[model samples]
Target: MSVCVKGDTILYGSDNYLKIADAADPSNPIEIGETSVPGDIYSITVRNEYAYLADIFNGLRIIDISDPSHPTEVGHYNNIYYTRQIVVRDNYAYVACEGEGLKIINISNPMKPLEEGSYETPGRAYSVALKGNYAYLAATNSGIRVIDISDPSDPFEAGYYPTEGYAYDLTIQGFYLFVAEGAAGLRIFNISNPLNIKQIGYYDTDGLASGISVEGNHAFVNDGIDSLFLIFDVSEVYFPQETGCYKTATANWSSAVNGELAFVASDGAGLYILDCSLAPTLLQSFNIRQAETKMELSWDISSREGITGFKIYRTTNEEQPMTKTTSPTIPITASNHYEYTDNDLINGKSYTYTLAVRDSDGSESVIGERTVTYKLPNIVYLCQNRPNPFNPSTSIECTLAEPAHLNLSVYDINGKLVKT
Candidate 1:
């Protein structure tokens, strides 16, 4: 189980199947696309419009992820088996092939990846990470091995660090190499000098650490044995402290963030997406009812947990910015229903109304928008003719909504000269 995040889309692998999920609403994960692979997916790395996967029996497979919902395989390299993990940098992919060591393939052309180089490590390669001119391999029992890939066609090892436990995964930040040492937990190594790398600090998660991901000063580690996910503060490398943790059914993958979304691949449990924004889901809907020269707008909120109120915006044309229609703001209430009546709209004209939810943190997001044309029926009224049956004179009155030329002709009461 592994995951790769790009923008609001996530490419996660579950056994032999790969899928794309939409994380626009971090609270709920929605699958947008999927495809089947030949082998169990071990690792995934994305670049441009394609995703590179290390398919155990399939070697290396390049998938076109431009269309998340319908991802398709574009190319493959099946020379070696047990392809554990892969890392793509520039025009080449560095793959960790268990017994085959490290294999470099030039992917300048995504459809035809050509083998360019190879380096055999003393241990079985399970994972790989990249830096300037070095490639770090998480060689299960043999630990971390640094390979220099400056010469793609002829790569060589530059350093090696032996860990106490099985090294399942690894990541690099600055001069530090963070390794997920199976039973040994999270291990940190200082590799300023590739040839003289040394262990600086480590954290025992009390379980099996199989996957890890680092961003900024925090590291997210997944334990396969206890199904535990841990967050560490690595600001002080010597003492990486645990800040938070979430338990799943069987966590075996890592994390990558899009905005405030954190993704993890848990065995049996599938993919779990966390919304760090702590925003409520907009469950209710916004509706507009058209009336003569006016509009009746109503909307509902699922909950007002972190919400301060709501704001309504109005516009005649989308080319122009909408103006706020709500006064002050619609304050949160015990009731979920919110209604507002907008009057004095031009007849036979369209108007757009947008509803935005404002949070207590001052962040606001548009929930819904709708456009409607206002119209009114045509009608005219006429007063009763005065002095009925009078021979001398009679008074008449007529009223119409719009201005128009009127033609009047006085004639005997024989329904003459008056056209309907």
Candidate 2:
């Protein structure tokens, strides 16, 4: 149905808040522009041409990106200590503030944000996901707290369920709540009755599943360590089955999606955009890919654009990637074309290789597929920072063709900027 594939170009605080790239053309992504934000960007929600960013301690930053090439900050609010997560519906913005509980701000006037109301919880609230008029708050050890935001100016607590451990992140769909419970794995709750929630089902992926995003019948969960998306089939709310799973070029931390594409945020790896129509398609690969030794890699390209070049990435354990190498810019005027042979590869050892194609328009596709064992090099390829039930520091690594701009920052338990 849809023809174009969209990729998420991630930007974070440590990277100065902007990773400007244009992938309108799924194959070759071009760096169009870059700008600076007041705080480290933690979460981003786009409505219309404006992007609402929850920037840690910096509060909510309203940026006008009518022109994606020149994004300018138009407004901001610094009331909350740490703006961990946010959900905007109509004129109201619901924020989950660490120690501040839940904050309701009026953003009718994007420039001047006004505080409407606040509610305190037992533990620190880290993430907030909203569906319809209900706001689901991940209250860490305090569990999953549900609030009725039908009245934006004043949100009232409708109900809550205190889990055994901590609830880190959640995704709401239809009448159900998919929560990423730290040690509890993926907990499903029936919110058909808003006032009283009921646990429906769950599945443990043997790792702390941190960020989650749902589309159609599939719910994608980010496994803290490996390069796999703990896939779950939720056609039957009572029992979710683990479907097929795949990894992105980087460690996938947070996930967002429309009907056709999925945007995954990889801490140091930038944004990974994937196509999820009938069967998931690897759109394009960005960043750099390099190995201690040379290697050969192959991947499928999801674009009709005249493929110009392919980008390759390498790492040691698939956790932290350290090198990137761009090819000599081949032209793909035909379909289902395969370009192979890296030639100069070293003799023994193991290596990881990801293929990225470049389009005539300059947009880049995500790196899909991996190969190891070519005079192996101890390279660091940062996958999405995982085991997200993190008490403090979470392991982060990324693949690079060459070391470019790199910075890793920590936010308070509440999502405020701590350090770089």
Candidate 3:
């Protein structure tokens, strides 16, 4: 039910044993080790010389994994009722102990793990991911609960996302938190500032997503209900597009990704090694910059070998289709800045730009259609004092294009300085 990767070493739990493999050659993963442990392993995390395992009933089982060929148990902390997932950082082991909430275990002494603190989660905790001073928990019906672990010995709740579906498992990449929602598919949230979290996007896999892993711009999600593994392009955080999928024999409960290879855990069918290099590396960024009367479109991408170049397309109205503004003109083989300056645009008029790729055979194919508008920068306008001929107090109004703070000073009719 759990899987983790450390360098080229891949470990997955099957029944009551942990299976280890060498995935240097992703196409043919070779088993290297196996270790038996009491209780079912729900999650696994490795750091340094130890592999921390969260057991459903056995609490935390710390295994010595310095040797990938033979992993051995070195410590255990079995006082909790249930431990579903664990995250080890520095000297602490953060355990999602089901109804018992999140337990902070000090593993500075791995052999004698001690409970340092605990946070009462709002719901049944399923998974936990750590970032900086916060620990994010996937609390089933309660959504994602952020626990401030800055003071591990005295953890407290910082915020919550209130997930849309059954939050199962979660992982953190950069400042974004990716959650595997059982029925709601995959949920993505921006945790740049942990306290002020916002949902950025979500992809409905059309099945129960029990586990997920993200690599680069791709997200590998496992669907347990429909026996499928889905991959999505999350380069655009607001709109995650499903670019690939693989159907398994049985239910795929959990999965992990290492570069171009994906390791999946199939309930009864065993581990699945898949080649994920087929997923295309796409445009990393596309932006629009506006000048007085023209807009400059800039974009850059990876793997420019098989492509000819880029073709710029434009449209002024949504009802009207986009037309190619120029031929295939941006050579990307050795250039870093690929841009096109579209001129003669009218002020205050909004135009949308679409980016397409001209294939080798002179055929234009849409890589992905996206819109960026630097339409017009806002201008600050100060309206004449309202109710000009007012009595003691008059209303003054001002408009700003964006949010900002400013000071206003009032002067008397005789040109005398007044209150501000």
Candidate 4:
């Protein structure tokens, strides 16, 4: 069985049913809906209002989840060998069919999914990830196979990286690829050059590494055998070091992260939600607002022991290094709120802001991050209404350069005041 999270909903695959659960409170997941499939569902991927299921022998099953409480099957595609995992991109669904390799199916038409191409690998394809025009497949015994998917109708193998252990799962962040190598532990590879993928570093865990998810500077890995959740510092892409680990009673199948929470799916423990935040717990909300010429950031914090102060970092290019915009000695008090306005920003430019707290002992930890794009100056610009022809309702947009209390009224074709 497998699980995928989208927003506040968790799509779980088990037996022959696809269950949808409300994850507002990840710890206490409440099943809201379920739909039976033709075969045992092993994996799932959710996009928009549809949930794509990898049903072993049944191939791909598409279910409409527009109404989470009442899901309905919309389409199905058979003839693929034991589909294990799936990753949907654009209008195509990439399936990791065990023994059958990679099967690319065009999903532009939800009612009819067609097989656009297939690439048979040496080993069973268990998981897949797409980057650029290449498809990275974690083939059980065959390791990682890099296939050029520029031509979806005719995909060809570009390269292969033979791993020491069973490559169960893999995720890519930037130029680095983190692999969960069963008994081999967590393996980090530099995929800057997919053709020459190099294993730069690895951390041998106490148990079998079954799944992994990376966020910011940390990598969350589940050790299936030892039933432990391991956290590693991946700030240095080449050399990863374990920072902390939590012991779980049941084997953790996989993990996904949203904000400060790490959701772990276990074999028997159901779902476990962990507080993966740094020190100085965020009490209220972290907000970003744009003014005429500046951007304002405000957040509330609940103090913790050993906390010194807080620091802020800003960057225009996420790929490049961020600059420290605030001093490390910034004052902080228990149950206090703070606000900062940055005027040194260019209009229409995007910027990322990060908040970190430091301890008296000089140890610093990142608490959270937010990205915002400054809006360009617009002096009374009105856009045409959408769905111009005729519809029950349409949307009209307007922009103003400065704040003003101006009235906007909409009239019918006969100059009748319809809305204001």
Candidate 5:
């Protein structure tokens, strides 16, 4: 799985390579191609279509994936140190070299990736993140080491913070550096003062913090143990807390998101993509009594991203595919409060109904359905309205499939009361 930028797409593989993709649509991804090498791939960096890959035992390899599907190897720089991860800025590539410290390479020319220089660290380096001209090194067991890369060819250590445990991965957003500090959990740092990095707050979970990515006020973390993806609300920097978590299909190594969706990569479970369009789940159906010709329909409100409102649609042809043109929306805000009357609908006609939740981004999730067979008013088969496209009125019956206290009425398109 890969976590790409809002405009750029990326993918990682254990085959000693990484796949750069087009992220135009978060749900449907387009692969640019695969970059290959030897040792297992640990991380990737893509600028335009050019990708920089770090292989465990093979050092750093460069490939041009401008064509995506036919990524070709352009150049490579092999070293004696075990390369774990890397980040590219300007013409320089900063590599987390295990045991030997951090290595910097100049890739101003894709055809010839030249080794610029190397800087020795006090401990093994696991990952690296670059902000401005400064680089944050995830030095395992030694915490986070800040390095000034203003001079790409010769990077020097600026400051160090012992996070109290093994630092596996780190990411930067704004002036904060989030560290995936293994058993110590997630450590948030105030980097407004780069040279004087300070830990402002932290959130500890039972799982080991393996990898992390930050976007806005939210942070997604990969728990090394059981392929768990833990999401936290970092909106409040000083005291961030876990809001939700999900276990991927397999044990995962890394996770990333682009606000609307989350990406998880598992060694055994492959890659799993999730749609987080809703905050709180809503009940699908509502049924009232037989006498109420108009029934009020509502649902729980959600605050998650991409949330819009709710839609009510009808379909007489159950075998045909349900399309947007076939469904009519019933606008709702904080609650799912909508009322429709059926004075014009034939009382004995059978109809099927559905409720669709519309997201702020315009994506919709139509709820699971159960059909309704309309009958005599007093016969009481109170299932919610169907084919909610009523020029004047719609029907609601009640034998009571679900409990509902509804005050149904009729109103014109302009908010004028027609029937009470």
Candidate 6:
């Protein structure tokens, strides 16, 4: 079984039925509708008003989900290979056809999904992720194959990375790609140079890594055999470490993320929703306050246990990288609260701060984030011109705490307004 969340609805595939449930309350999913299919549904991807299903032997089936309670089949394409996974992006649907490899279908018209192109890989294509014009495919034993989908009619392989274990699934974030390599665990690759994809780091998970989902600086993966859902801190792309693990009853196949909640799919145990908002423990209250030109951060920990200390990170741009601002705090057995101040920050710039707690075993987990903007002084001040003697040009500066409209006039020695 597989599931995908869209808006307030959770679309899932079970046996030969495509079930649609209202996920207003993710804890208790209410099945509102279901559509029957000829073949067993392996994966489903919903985009806009359509739900694209990867029907095992029946191939791709597009259903019109404009009305949640009454879904009607719009289009379909039967193929020879078993379609295991499907991902819809823009006007294209990338299908991971088990033995047939990657199949690209044009879905510009919901009533008619035509085959655009396909690329055959050595092993079974289990999953796919499309970024820009390239399609990253996880071909079971063949590892990861990067295909240029720039030309949908003729998709060609651009690069390949062979893994020791079966590459079950993958997800991309920024310049890094996270792959769930069966028993080999979660493999992190630097895709900045897609042609030269290199493995930077890896975390040996306890069980078979079947699926993965990335949110912010964390990656949630499922261990199929152990029925465990694992969370890793991927903030340091080159050094991913496991932070938390949740055990389920059955085989955990895949995971989907929405906000702080992780929707997991377990083969026979059914669906499970996990609260991944914060670390398992160790964090109490984390806050930030602005004092004049500096920003102060304070956090409290309820339990120390095997924890070593905490590390603080700051970033100016959300898209840009983050930097560690302070050294790791010294672990104290009695202290519960700690404080740090970021001094001499440029005024009018926004900053984001994250606090991570480290364990005695060298593993770290991000606890919280605080975003604050530094403002100018409360009173306006105009500085004197840099050069006393006039040259062609001199720098003039002024500061304002609040928004304002002001006009500056420049006068010559004659006292006549020359420039404004």
Per-model TM against the reference: 0.64, 0.61, 0.74, 0.66, 0.64, 0.71
The superposed Cα distance between candidate 5 and the true structure at residue 277, in angstroms, equals: 3.9
lDDT of 1 by residue, 146-184 (tens): 999889999999878878999999999999999999999
RMSD to the native, candidate 5? 17.1
Q: Candidate 1, which segments miss by more than 4 Å at Cα? A: 275-420
Candidate 4 lDDT over residue span 169-275, tens digit each: 89899988999999999999988898999998788887889888888878989888888988887764554656678888787777778777787777766667788
lDDT (tens digit, per residue) of candidate 2 on 26-46: 356676655677767666776
lDDT against the true structure, per candidate, is: 0.82, 0.67, 0.83, 0.83, 0.71, 0.84
The reply for model 3, stretches above 4 Å from the true place, is 282-285, 289-292, 296-420
Q: Which candidate is the best by TM-score?
A: 3
Better of 2 and 5 by lDDT: 5
Q: Which stretches of candidate 2 lie over 4 Å from their true place?
A: 1-14, 225-227, 248-251, 275-420
Model 1, position 358, has a per-residue lDDT of: 83
What TM-score does candidate 6 get on C-alpha atoms?
Answer: 0.71
Instruction: List candidate 5 segments past 4 Å from native.
Output: 1-10, 17-32, 279-420
Ranking by lDDT: 6, 4, 3, 1, 5, 2
How many clashes does the backbone of model 6 have? 0
lDDT (tens digit, per residue) of candidate 3 on 220-334: 8989999999988887776676768999999887887877888888888888888888886566778887764467777877657557788777887644667546864666568
lDDT by residue (197-234, candidate 5, tens digit) is 89987888688888998766678889978678888767
Which should have the higher lDDT, number 2 or number 6? 6
Q: How many backbone clashes does candidate 1 have?
A: 1
